[model samples]
Target: MATKEEDVKLLGFWASPFSRRVEIALKFKGVSYEYLEQDIFNKSALLLELNPVFKMVPVLVHKGKILAESLLILEYIDQTWKNNPILPQDPYEKAMARLWAKFVDEQVGPVCFKSVVKADKGIDVAIEEAQELITFLEKELSGKDFFGGKTIGFLDMVAGSMIPFCVARAWEGMGIDMIPEEKFPELNRWIKNLNDIEIVRECIPQREKQIEHMMKVAERIKLA
Candidate 1:
């Protein structure tokens, strides 16, 4: 296990899935650090100092060196600790794991954005694409407790962040529960299983908070 290092810090926002991804990676790897919550809507001096270009949260500061981007931060955390390896050792498996991560990164943002807009045509298209993504996950998750098999891996961390937020937000807005008890039993089981894990349970933000955040965002979009 990697011992806690001095000056290890996370610049993140509570509601950001990007930030949660890195936070979950740190918890999973048993790394200890300080967390500074940033408001992306109101960019902080610290956030600007860390990531001037993107001006985003989730800047990982370690021993004075700064890293941005959640996936890259996750990789850095995995490599730095040398314990609780999230990616598999085998080259092929590792490749597969990365593929899933990339797929989620490219797809989930647009899907969630459209879902929140509550537009009939846009939401219909978004729902169709979202269903395809879920179907793909269902196939990937077939006969496996996790994408990394018995253990929660890199892909698991990314997926975990989104599903909980999606479940919380969608239920409130659309009244369409994505992770229904009937459909997606395997994925539902995985979500519940993850909820039971100590690290996952601890890192997960409250559902009420997420719902509130989503409501605010939706309201803002309505006015603008």
Candidate 2:
């Protein structure tokens, strides 16, 4: 449990899924904190001071100590507030969760952007890679409401950041079906399950807003 005197502050960008991951974890843990929205284009002195190396958004400041990286922030939140634990108790399961979380963070962008946005690299290759990733997740989510089985857990939160936000909106912006109902039924179901959760849904940016942003990005890529 967080002490009353311990101040928790989150420096984040509004549309960043990485930042949203930390927000979801904090909300899930029922930890009260201050949220300082940052303008990444014009970096703030506070953000630079806290995250000197990366100077990025989604910096978690707890009782004067600063933590960077979304996954690490999530872990810190879980550890700080023992209630509503996110990671699994079993060591092996925890390791698996961390592995998938890292995979989602590293791969989701390239796989999603290349598939939907016009690029020198063909969309076919990106589609194949995206399908491979989705298939793995489908198998993992088989017979489970979430990656955590009954409830949302660490992997669920991490995967949730990518799936319905960037990937889904990218496909929508392209007017093509990537995760079709017939092809990725299990994965689609899992997406719905995650979205239905109030905490996840509340923090998610509006779908229309995401689509508009993605279209602008795609246009920029084309112009470049």
Candidate 3:
């Protein structure tokens, strides 16, 4: 019998954009792998053993090696498979992809989510913070179809869940407009572009499902 990592396997959660980034990267590269859905709120022994320090999803196993962190897994997937490269080839472009991907994941995404939840409580301050964080991406996306440029690339996959995916559903659930076209035209245009991509549409969780899940998350955040 083949060893556990003799073939590719991804331990992930459906609602987690981090792991979804890995899944999208794999799909882009046309790599075959097994998908294991994890209940991160209730960590499994395997997940604990595989990633004791962080105990996070998006843990990738390939050729018996365990890789943690969604961005790291994305890099590994791109390098491991040459076809349909995710990161750009140019040195500067590749660096920018990594930078923006990191920024969206670490900075922009959190603020956006918090803003959505807080906006429901009649708090406009969080919206201001969200706009401030989003302005960086708005300027960066100027005159570009994607952060990765013409085609969806590494940064696109990383920010996939946060932007159009989460923002679209979250804003609808809150019954408010966030990132209006007049204000963030580039980002809105980017959202339209992403919506037109079949694979992107397929990869994201359903809109109603995401909205329900995000509302549940909002409740938790309120308690916290």
Candidate 4:
């Protein structure tokens, strides 16, 4: 078990999945730290100073060294604490984990969720595209308990944060079943597994607040 690190501080938002994932990683490592709830809608000077490039939440400040980007921060946490290893020991598996994690961040996640969340504007991203993304996931999850196998790992922290209630319920609220249990049993099972973990559930943002925040982000996108 990792002891409390007084120097480690997290600047995060309540409804940001990226933030939630960092929190999950921190809990997994059992590294005690300060949780600074940031207003992502209104970035603070500290957040701006820490991460001027993106000015994003989920910033991990350790020993006065600031790290931004959720994936990078997760890796830092794993390397720094060296407890509850998030990555696989096998190099091949680690590479594959990284591959899918990038795919989630770049290809699959945004294309699927942005379409539904930004529905108010005339955004008509084909539902088929979203379904295709889910199909890729369903296939990848075949015969495996998780993307990183039986235990949750780096990819789990990356993709799991994005694929749960916010995306599914957001699509459902739009009268679109993005992931039907029967059609995507493996993915659904993966979701169930993630949600079943106490720490993962604890880090999850409150449902209503999350949805409200999603709508606010959509509105911001519309006006922008």
Candidate 5:
């Protein structure tokens, strides 16, 4: 029983990368919306009603219509709004962006979550997985500012959503400093460019907060 509003509404978890992806798209498009933060541990009835399948956050409610899955919601926003296009107009480029978005969405978050939470065998696996994910990004973005070249597009947002996760885990938890300024120069430049953007900075969840949660989650995983 929600009131009718002629605007977008986002039901999401603050620290979730999936939620961040949708938030980034909304910011880029300048689509003003109400943001409802949901606790993953104790989901609200509203969230459950909006997205019953996964029972997850990042459910985009537009004019009473609900959209689940971050990637699909982004595409829906781009298509519906028809301004500040996230994907390239060219078919081939758009297809490539979609592929990378799918690739990163499928792999990055789960692996990083495992690294943050499970300190046992999962940690070792997550490290290797993280390296593999980073290597893919390094090669894909060899000499470009973003995956879309000079602009943060769909693929950029898709991959960039995970930046806070990797940065926090490496610098805070592991103290590994994996994404050094020299090692992944392109990545470093890209991250700086994204960080400098006002909308991106404002919408993105803080790295320190994510790190703190990661520590708590890790301990819980160990005890469990």
Candidate 6:
């Protein structure tokens, strides 16, 4: 539980879309937090202590309590603030939201990253899997401004962070077109709309920097 005296702090890496998810949630909820940029390659002592098990970025420290994982942190933010609700009120809708969020994070996101970074070896298979995942999501998003219908919700936040910030950048860096505008018009529009939001505008990484970082990762994968 967060308190008035104890400050909210985020430990994150700039290049990680996972970290951006937490940032977007905090901003959308109108929560003021101290952002601590972590060097993921050489992690800081704070990050190490807070998330000793995973040793990863996107860790949230509130009132001296540590919360790891972006999704969990997002839910916590929504629960604590009670403003700009991210999750739906209904039980079933909330469950569905969680389902899609997990799918994007666990399945779609990994496949897209594999497609780009391992392009030389497994681009075809990875791209096919990614396309299938995107197609399913496109169908789910049909006739809606967002996955949550009217406004950006939990699923929107997760998908928005992964698609535009991570997958799109990976494809761009690899010189491939995964989500062609003509083929996936809805997804494209969703990306545009989500990014246009003020909180997202403040949190999303620069295109050039994302591409550069992804390209470097691709090169490393090739060498490995």
lDDT of each: 0.78, 0.83, 0.82, 0.82, 0.77, 0.85
Candidate with better TM-score, 1 vs 4: 4
Model 6 ranges with Cα > 4 A deviation: 1-6, 119-122
Candidate 2 Cα lDDT to native: 0.83
In model 2, the clashing pairs are: none
Q: Tens digit of lDDT per residue, candidate 3, span 111-212?
A: 777766766645577677777888998898899998888888998888776677776567667775778899999988988888788777767888799888
Best-to-worst TM-score order: 6, 4, 2, 1, 3, 5
Question: TM-scores of all models?
Answer: 0.91, 0.91, 0.90, 0.92, 0.87, 0.93
| Candidate 5 structure, TM-score to reference | 0.87
Q: Pick the candidate with the highest lDDT.
A: 6
Best by TM-score: 6
- Residue 170 of model 6: what lDDT? 76
Misplaced by over 4 Å in model 4 are 117-125
Query: How many pairs of residues collide in each model?
Result: 0, 0, 0, 0, 0, 0
lDDT of 1 by residue, 1-224 (tens): 64565768999888887888788888888888899988789899889988998899789999889999988898888889888799899999988888888877777655555554655566567566566667677778889988888989899988777765643364455565655657677887788778888887777777777877777777676576
Model 6 Cα displacement at 108 (Å)? Answer: 0.7
Per-residue lDDT tens digits for candidate 5, residues 1-224, read 22233577999888787888888888888787889999999999998887899999789999878999998998998888787789899999999888877777666656555554564566556566566777777788988888888788898888887665544453366565556677678877888888888877877766677777766766676687
Ranking by lDDT: 6, 2, 3, 4, 1, 5
Candidate 4 lDDT by residue in tens digits, 147-195: 8788788888888888775666566556677788988999989999998
TM-score of 6: 0.93
Sliding window of 10 residues with minimal summed lDDT for model 6: 1-10
Which is better, 2 or 4, measured by lDDT? 2
| lDDT-best of 5 and 6 | 6
**Candidate 1: TM-score?**
0.91
